[model samples]
Target: MEIKIDDLQGSGIIRLLEEHLADMHATSPAESVHALDVKALQHPSITFWSAAEGNSVLGCVALKSLSCDHGEIKSMRTSGAARNRGVATKLLNHLIADAKSRGFKQLSLETGTQAFFSAAHGLYAKHGFVDCEPFGDYQPDPNSKFMTLVLEQ
Candidate 1:
């Protein structure tokens, strides 16, 4: 799989993002929904990437700078057809490596508390992320679960 910085204007990537956002909103509560739309993902503080095989988009992830030493994971999603093939894992690993390269000391994320998010939560845990309180603009919401990983570098 090739992971490349994404141009939000691309129709394929845009469609994947739109589908991800819609799935999140449909399964998660209003306050627990944190997936960003194309406009928001294009913010200067966020770096977005897409995992693709030729012309097909397999998955995507984004890193949003929260501070000089901190970053938040955002908009992580793997295409339905690409599930169980380690696509999300690769995208996440790429984001984590990018954060470390940028001198970030911590990486955080927010996911749902429902069973729908179990695989995601497990994936994060496998990468050393531990449950934590809400960070940044987030407030405690019963429907959400927060996790963070402290970078060794």
Candidate 2:
């Protein structure tokens, strides 16, 4: 599989992001949903990437700059057919390496607290992320769980 930086304009990538946002809303309350739409993902502060095998998109992930030393992981999604195939793991490792190269000291993310997100929690935990207090503009929300990974230089 190949992973490449994306501009959020391709139809396949957009469709996957739409599905991701929809799943977030379906699993979390409207007040707790933080997934960004296509336009939001295209912000200058964010870098989006897609993982594909030739012409088939397997997954996608994004990194959003929060500060000079901190960044946030956003919009991580793997196609249903691609789950359990290490797609997320590969993309996450890529983002972590990229983050370090870009001088980010930490990477954080917000996900749902419900059972629907348990798999995600495990995935992050497996990658060395630990539970943390809300960062950035986030506040304490029962439906939201925050995780952070402190990157080493």
Candidate 3:
């Protein structure tokens, strides 16, 4: 699969992001559902990416600049049809690589504390991310688990 920057306009990506937000709301309280919709991901401070093969959009991820040397991972989701095919991992690796290339000193993310997020927690841990205090605009929330990977920049 190819991973590249996306403009968040394709039909496939729009549908996938909608599904992502729907699941987020279903799994967490409204106030805690931080998943971005298509419009939100298009912000100038955020860079969005799509992983696809030919005409099929397999997954997508975004990085939001929280500071000159820090970025927050946002809106990471794999298409329902593409789960377990390593889509999330590829997108994450791409995001991490981009962060390093941009001279970011750290990459952080906020995910749910629910059982539905167990796999995500494992994925981040496997990639050397450790639990951390909330960063950026986030505050302590019982439903949120924050993780960070400090890049050797």
RMSD to the hidden true structure, all candidates: 0.7, 0.7, 0.8
Q: For residues 33-142, could you state the per-residue lDDT of candidate 3 as single tens digits?
A: 88988878889999999999998999999999999999999998898799999999999999999999999999999999999999899999999999999988889999
Q: Order of candidates by TM-score, top first?
A: 2, 1, 3
Ranking by lDDT: 2, 1, 3
| lDDT of every model, 2 decimals | 0.94, 0.94, 0.93
- Model 2, stretches more than 4 Å misplaced? none
Clashing pairs for model 3 are none
On TM-score, who's better, 2 or 3? 2
Model 1 segments more than 4 A misplaced: none
lDDT of 3 at 7: 90
- Candidate 2 Cα deviation (angstroms), residue 64: 0.5
Clashes found in each candidate (C-alpha, N, C closer than 3 A)? 0, 0, 0
Query: Which candidate model has the greater lDDT, 1 or 3?
Result: 1
Score candidate 1 by lDDT.
0.94
